[model samples]
Target: MEDMSRLDNACHRPLRSAAALGLVAVLTAGCTGTDADTTTAAVGRAAVETSPLPTVPPAQPASQLTRAEVETAVSRLDGVVRDAMRRTGVPGVAVGVVHDDKVLYLKGFGVRTAGTKDRIGVDTVFQLASVSKPLASTVVAAAVGEKTVAWDDPVIKHSAGFTLKDPWVTRHVTLADLFSHRSGLPDHAGDLLEDLGYDRSYILDHLRYQPLAPFRAHYAYTNFGLTEAAVAVARAAGTSWEKLSAEKLYRPLGMDSTSSSFADYDKAADKASLHVKTGNTWRAEHVRDADAQSPAGGASSTVRDMTKWLRLQLGNGTFEGRKLIDADALEQTHLPHIVSEPPHAPAGRAGFYGLGWNVSYDDQGRLKLGHSGAFALGAATNVTLLPSEKLGIVVLTNGEPIGVPEAIATTFLDTAQTGGPTVDWLTFLGPIIKQAAEGERSPVDYSKPPASPAPAKATSVYTGTYANDYFGPMTVSAKGGELTMQLGPKKQRFLLRHYDGDTFSYRTTGENAVGLSGVTFTVGSGGRADKVRVESLDTTGLGTFRRNG
Candidate 1:
C-alpha cells in the first residue's frame, strides 16, 4: 500500500503564515558637554551617546491607491499573473482585486483547459473550495443578527440528532464552536465516510465513533463541524444552506454568478474546466461534487461575483448602500477565536482561526484575513483581505497542487502597497510547488517486490464476505488464481496481489473506489482470515472489517 500518512499530511497541513518583510531603521544623536568628572565617567558618557544600535520603527500603515496608481498596479499585476501561470503550468486563472469600495482589477488569463480554444473570462465559474467557509459563516451571522439563532446556543438544540464521541462535548458544543473548528473532532475525521457514499446526516450521526481532541484544547480543522453548523443555520432559517446563502448573501451582495450547487456549475455557460498536471502537461480531471459537504467547501463562483463579496467584507456587512447584516454580528465572524500554529509566519505576527477565516498579521502589523482551498487534484483557490487597508484579492486556478495562487496573492499585496514587487515570490515558492507536484505525479510505487512470496495459508482461505459499519461491505473471493475484493454498492473490484506475510495490495480500477492501496487480513481459527484492514485514500487509520458468514 502507498503511504497514506504522507498523502494526508500533504493534502491537509495547516496553512503557513505570510512571509516577513525586511525593514530596518536607525536613530542616532550626538551630544558634546564639558565634564568636570573623571576620565572614566567621560568615556562612559561618550560610549552611551555615540553607540549606533539598530532600531526598528513602528510599521507604517498601507496607503490608499489613486486612480492612476491603480491602473499602473493592474498593468504590472497582469504581467506577474501571466508569469505565474507559465512557470507553474496552471491552465487558467481568474483574479479579482478590490480596493475599498471599488474593484480595481477583475480579469482572467490563459485557456480554460490545456490544448483548448476556450478562453477564460472574469465571469467563468470555478469551485471556491474552503473559501466557501466565510460565505457560509456570513449566512449564520445573518441568522444571529436577526435573532433567529444565537452563537452560544448548543448545537443539539438546533440539530436534535447531533452527537459526538464524548457525551459532554455532544451536549456542550456550541454554534460558535462549530464555526471555530473547536468541536473536538479530529481533523477531517468524517471525510472517509463522505467519500464512502454516506450523506451529511449519516456522517453527522457517526461522529460519536470518531475520536476527539479535548474541547477547545487544540486546533483541528474539520469540515464536518462546519457542515453541522450550516445544518443548524439552515434549520433555524427554515431553508437549505444553499437557499439561505443565496437569499441572504449572494443576492444582497450582487453576487449573481455564485452558487452552492453542482447542478448550477453544470448548467453555467461559462465555467472553468478542472485540470491537473500529468508529468509535463495539464490534463482535464473530474471535479469532485461537494454537495454532501456544501457548507464546508462547495461554493462555485466567478471573479466578478467575488469582487462584490469583497466589497461587502470591506464595507463591514454593507454593500451598495444597503446594510445586509448587523455590523456587530458580522464583525464577530472576523474576530479571532483560537490561535493556530502556522508553519510559516511573519516576524512578530501570530496566526489565528476566526469564525470561518484564517487571521494573521501582515509585515506592516495590520490584520490580514484569508483562506486557501484545494479541491484534491482539481483546482486551488485563495482569498486575501487586508481589513486595515480596505484591500482584498482573490485568485482561482484550474490546475493545481500549485502555489501559484498564494504567490500571486502575496505579490499583489506587496505591489499594491509599495507600487512594485519587492519579493521574489516564484523563487521562494519553487521548492514547495515542486514538492507538491512530485507528490501528485507519484502517488504510489509498486516497483519493489514484496518481502514475502505468499499468504500464510491457501488463498482460498481468505475468500469470504467482510463488512464495516460505516463503509458498508466488501467481499473477497479467489478468481483465476488471484484474490479479488469488491466494495460497497458499486461492487468495484480490484485484483489483489500478495505483498507480504498476510498483506495484499490492490490498484483501484474504478474512479470512485479507493486509490492504489493495501489490505492486511488477520488469520483466525482453521487458517481463515477473520479480520481485514485497509490502507487507502479514504482513511488515514487502518479500517477493520470483520468476516461475516
Candidate 2:
C-alpha cells in the first residue's frame, strides 16, 4: 500500500499533535552547575562563596494559575514574538490574545512580504489554512443553534449525492463522524485531486471510490471529509458555505476582514504574502488558492478579526454582552470525540479530537482546545483557548511551517502557567516540521536513473489512452521524439523523460507533489502497452490505470 503513513510526514496541517504537556519528554535541568561546598574551612570565609549561588534562574510561572496570574505570561508576548521572529526569520507574524472578555493583546512583527517595506499589522490578513476547521465548526454550531443541522444528523439528510464506499456506512455516518474525522476515509482521501486542479464538488462526490477503514472505529484525518460535513450544514441552511459563514458567523461577529472566499484574500490591500525560506532569505514566491476546501482550510482573516472569534469562543457563544449562538451547541465542539494521539507510554495521557479542535486536559483538569494550520507552500497559524481561565491566543504567520507560530504560542502559554517556558519549543518543533517536509519526497531517487539502464522500444508502444475508474482517463502522446502525459479534468500535461525500459519520469507538481516520479508502462503480447503506473498517485495502491480497449 506504499506506506500510507507517508501521509503523516507530508501532511502540512496535521490534525493531531505529539507536543502536548504530558507527551513531550521535557528535560528541564540544563543549567549544568553544581552549588556544592567542597572546602569546609572556607565556609567561614565569605560563607564558602557557594559557587556564586549557582546562577539562580528566574521564577517559572506556576504549574497552574488562577485567572489573575495569567498576566505574567500575556505581558511578555511582545518580546517573545520579537525574539521568535529574530531567531526563526519567519518574515511576518500577527498575534492576538483575549482575556476576561477583553482584548489583551493585538500586535504584529516583521514585514508583510519579505524584501519589502510593507509592514504587517493587526489588520493584515493571512490565510488560516486548516485553522479554518475550528472557525467552520463555529458556523456549523450556529446552524445547530438555530436547529438547521444537528450535530448527530445523518449527512445524506442535508447534502445530497454524498456517499462512501460502504453503502451501510454511507447511510449511517453523521456530521459528527465526519467532523471528528472518524468516517473511515483514508488519510487525506481526496487532496490529490485538489492538487490536480479538481474542484470541491468533484472531489467530494468521488470519495466513494476510495477504500475505507472500519467506519467510525478508525481515525484518519481527511480534509474533504470534514469539508463534506460543513457543505451539508450549509445545504441544510439553504445557503452556500461561504454565505453561510458570512450570515451566521462573520457578519454577525462584525469580522469584516474575514472571508471564506479566496478572492478576498487575493485582493486584500493589507495582507501578508505567503513566504518560504530560500538560502537564508524569506521569499514570497508562492500563491495558494484553497477555495476547493474552503470550509476545511481556505478561510483568511486578520488578527483584529480573529480576536472577535476568540472572544466568542471564550464567551461561550456570546459576544460583547449578546448571545450570538447557543452555548450548548458551541460547547459541544470542544468535547472530545475521538482519540487522536494515543500515549507512547502507559503513564502518558492520550489526546482527543473535539470537532475541529485538538482537545486535551491539563494537570489541573482545565480544558485546553487548540488547532494549528499549515501550508507547505507557505502559511502557518495557530489558535489556542483555555476556556477554564477565559484566556485564548491566536498567532498567524506568512511562512511555511517551521514551528514558528506553534513555538511562540507554546512559549507564551508556558510562561503563563509556569513563570517561563520550560522547554525550548522550537528545538523540538523544527525537527518535526523538517522531517515531515522531507518525508513527502519520493523514497526512490528518480532524478538519479539506474546505471546501465535498459533502452526503451519505439514510442509508439506507449502512446495510447488508458483508463482507471479512480484516476479517470490518462492519455500519453508523443510528438517529435518527446512524450507527454495528460490527465485530470483539465488534462494537465506532464512532460515525460525516459528513465529506463518501459519507465519514464515526470516532475510532480501540486500540493502532494513529491518530486520526479516513475510512470511505468506494461506492454502486452499484442505490442501496445496495457497499463501505466503513476508512482506519485499510487500511495494507496490505486495509481494503476488499466487499458479500456
Show how many residue pairs clash in every candidate, following the order shown.
0, 5
lDDT tens readout by residue for model 2, 262-293 = 99999999999988788788898889899988
TM-score of each: 0.84, 0.89
- Candidate lDDT scores, in order, read 0.67, 0.76
Off by over 4 Å in 1: 1-71, 342-348, 433-446, 508-515, 537-542
Candidate closest to the true structure, highest TM-score? 2
lDDT of 1 by residue, 1-549 (tens): 000111212333221111101000000000000000013223323423422111332353665445565566667888999899878778899999888688889899988878989999998998877778888888888888999887778788888888776766777777877787766677666666665566777777777777666666455667778888888888988889889989889887878889988789778888888786777888886766777778877889999999898888888888889889877777777766655543332433345667777655543455666766666446677787877667788988887545677678766765665677665766664445435323322134544555546644688788999878767788998877889888755566778887777878876431123345677789988679998987663343427888997
- What TM-score does candidate 1 get on C-alpha atoms? 0.84
Leading candidate by lDDT: 2
Q: Which residue runs of candidate 2 sit more than 4 Å off their true CA positions?
A: 1-68
In candidate 1, list every pair of residues with a backbone clash.
none
**Models, CA RMSD each:** 11.9, 13.0
